[model samples]
Target: MAEIQTTTLIDDLTGKPLDAEKAHRIHFSVEGKTYRLDVDEKGADEFHAALDRFIEVSTKVAAGGASKRAAAAPRRASAGSGEQTKMREWAKANGYEVAERGRIPAAIQEAYAAAN
Candidate 1:
């Protein structure tokens, strides 16, 4: 048998942090197994659509009006302006070291994501 599970900070549909204590949980089973997960605002986007579908199909989670976090969706840098270029500029401006060429470091990416 194999199993996998993890938890991430739950958020509301608007991307605001949600109180774990007040959050609702959904429980269901598939293939002779059971699983439970808390409603998360950020869990239903395209990134987690497969899991969302799995949970939805196997349970009545949708009937309860839970919504996926939509505010965390990656913003597309305006066409021609580009996020990479902006990221490079922001790093330099903030005194964060960046490669002159090639992929930006993950730290930089995280910072950039948090900023924009």
Candidate 2:
């Protein structure tokens, strides 16, 4: 029979040594709550698998968020364009204290857009 060899486990990110019990456990936090998941000797592999899935899903979500903002950029640009200057002038003429430069109020923008 061959002798079984035992080795210490180390956390890749924290650079901390883990004993057998801890090495067989995964720790995580969600919404201010902390939780631990214990597994058999396959725990290390399972933890890595979960981490991979989390990264993949979050990456997709982040990409979708960026695209949503990109899609809104054109509307934001139009809001500050010459149409807004025309609206500000209209609002000031109609007794609304329009700012010299900055965001024009939504009511003024709506009325001007409707007028045009």
Candidate 3:
């Protein structure tokens, strides 16, 4: 059997971090509310699985945020119509929904016409 590492995250009612550890048990009190976490070997395994899921989700969120920030940065002029069509087709095939409107607010139609 593979050895599993466990991690815990304890928070108060206000969502403030109380404690964190890599042990199978945790005890803490917050705002007069006491809490105890005791996990057996099986429970520890499950807890580790949950922690893995959280790490995966957090990584994905951070990556998405970074991607959005990068995309928000200004780029060179828009691509030509042929390139745009190829991009739209690629997006559709990859299960991404492409907006009908162009990136430019005004002169979009004119720009697209000139590109083609």
Candidate 4:
């Protein structure tokens, strides 16, 4: 005799069964609390798009939870013409993700200072 087993993956937010290939695991943290969600491709895209604004301005965290800004702590931005532009350019060139406009990450400022 032979037996077959099956399992269904459901989208947490939509409560619908997800196709195995379309299933996604999204992980994120908020206020120091970590979370995981199971969703389909569409849900994953929507979730990311909704958070894109905040995510762009936010600092990237290392796997172990330590971030450059948190460690640097309370640094000040230097004043000058096109400082933001220069920082953004440098950041992009150096593979850092920065927003189009907003509070610049202190780490980028520090790196720019050190570089030039």
The best candidate by lDDT is: 4
lDDT by residue for model 1 (41-63), tens? 44544335767666576645543
lDDT of 3 by residue, 25-94 (tens): 6453433466676644455577567667756765343323433534466666877887677666655565
C-alpha positional error of residue 41 in candidate 2 after TM-score superposition, expressed in Å: 8.4
Q: Assess each prediction's global lDDT (C-alpha) against the native.
A: 0.64, 0.67, 0.53, 0.85
Candidate 1 pairs with clashing backbones: 41-69
- Worst lDDT run of 10 residues, candidate 2, spans 59-68
Ten contiguous residues minimizing lDDT sum, candidate 4: 66-75
| Between candidates 1 and 4, the TM-score winner | 4
Over 4 Å off, model 3: 1-75, 104-116
Question: Candidate 4 at residue 66, lDDT?
Answer: 49
Error of 3 at 74 (Å): 6.7
**Backbone atom clashes (below 3 Å) for every candidate:** 1, 0, 0, 0
**Tens digit of lDDT per residue, candidate 4, span 1-116?**
99999999999989999998889999987776779999988899999999999989988867767433555576564656487888889899999999988877888878888999
Which residue runs of candidate 2 sit more than 4 Å off their true CA positions? 1-23, 27-34, 38-75, 79-82
Instruction: Show pairs that collide, candidate 2.
Output: none
